[model samples]
Target: MSKTLTITDNRTGKQYEIPIEHGAIRAMDLRQIKTNADDFGLKTYDPALMNTANCVSRITDIDGDRGVLLYRGYPIEQLAENSDFLETAYLLLSGELPTTAQLNKWKTNVTLHSMLHENVKKFMEGFRYDAHPMGIFLSTVGALSTFYPDAKDIFDEQSRLTQTVRLIAKVPSIAAYAFRHSQGLPYIPPDNELSFTGNFLNMLFRMAELKYEPNPVLERALDVLFILHADHEQNCSTTAMRTIG
Candidate 1:
């Protein structure tokens, strides 16, 4: 015979009745019941920091105790060794690896949109030498809405695609510029021939006197770092997005 399970949320005061297989009832257990606040260290509990309830991106899962991170169910170690940043981003956003054809198409799309507008570059030049890079990045991203207001049409797949491409392309440039500005150096244009991570490293470290070539081991390690930082559900930023939305 089939069984039914009922669950209620105290916060929302909502109840759900779910049908289950006959033996599924055996999975229900409520033996551990303790009310003393001391047992759970109530003093250490901070409601402001507790944010596991919100849900957002399906990018990565983090297990703090085990020191493990999985991106779209793929282990971080595997992705770092075998994958690139763009591939990992695609996996996080789309939930799977792109087929060869899809990858080619995606790469082409991103490459085509990599160039930032001249006006935006002029705006960057207006910032003071002492300005923080993160401030510049945030302001520049918000400025994108003004330059391409059509991106606000989030329901359009093409618009979303364009925005995604623009962000992926320009972020490295922005970061490199921020690095250079700290040293009072001019910004460098991106080199299209190189891979995403390779291009970023080149932009940051390339000197007029020396040809920059990224170390493969370092590139792979950086790829792993990006993968590990990709996403965590209900994280601070994710929670802020939820609250804002």
Candidate 2:
């Protein structure tokens, strides 16, 4: 049987009926609340959004009360134990795990785009020597829009794929550059031979004398960390980023 909520207006002795949607998860539909607010003179409030569900999603699901977390219907424990960040990313974006060939192709595309624009590198020199890495990273990411005009066409499949590759490829370089600037160290360029995390480590920690080497344990741990942070439905920062997009 379907369920409905009845809200009575004291002034006019009228009532508003709201339908309840029941599924694997139960939700109350509230889209019309604002439209009828004047008629009922009703006030809606949920402090800290304790009981509110603001949006719908097909990504991660978190139930704090139940201590459960799922990403694309797979348990967090299973993903953290069995999947690498790139595989998890493939699942999140495409709603399925990628085949070995697909994963390889995606990784190759990312590797090919790993270098930052030379002009962007020159622009970083203008920042104050004491500037924070995070500040520099934020500014440099914003500056990316100017370098990649093709990224503006979000509706184009190839453009979207290219920008996705660029973002994954470039962010590590940008981060490493920011760190190098903060430390007054010469920037270490990406090594195409290294895996994603390995390359980032090379850029972040390599010195004139010492070369960075990838540690299997450390790389796997970092991959799990990235997978864990891949998504959280309605997370404040994620929501903000979506809204901005």
The residue-level lDDT of candidate 2 at 162 comes to 82
For candidate 2, the clash count comes to 0
Please give each candidate's TM-score.
Answer: 0.76, 0.85
lDDT of 1 at 225: 76
Model 2 lDDT per residue over 1-245, tens place: 55766767565566767766433222333333443445443345666656655567778889889989898899989999988777887888888888999999878888899998899999897899999999999999989999999989999998997888788789999999999999999888899988888888889988875557877898888878888888866778766665465
lDDT (tens digit, per residue) of candidate 1 on 26-138: 22221111233344311223367452244434567778899888887888888877877788788877899998898888877777776778898888878898899888878
In model 2, what lDDT does residue 173 have? 97
User: For all the candidates, what are their Cα RMSDs to the real structure?
Assistant: 7.7, 3.4
lDDT against the true structure, each candidate: 0.72, 0.81
Model 1 / residue 146 / CA error / Å? 1.3
RMSD of 1: 7.7
State in Å the error of residue 53, model 2: 2.0
lDDT, candidate 1, at 125: 78
lDDT for model 1, please.
0.72
Cα-based lDDT at residue 189, candidate 2: 86
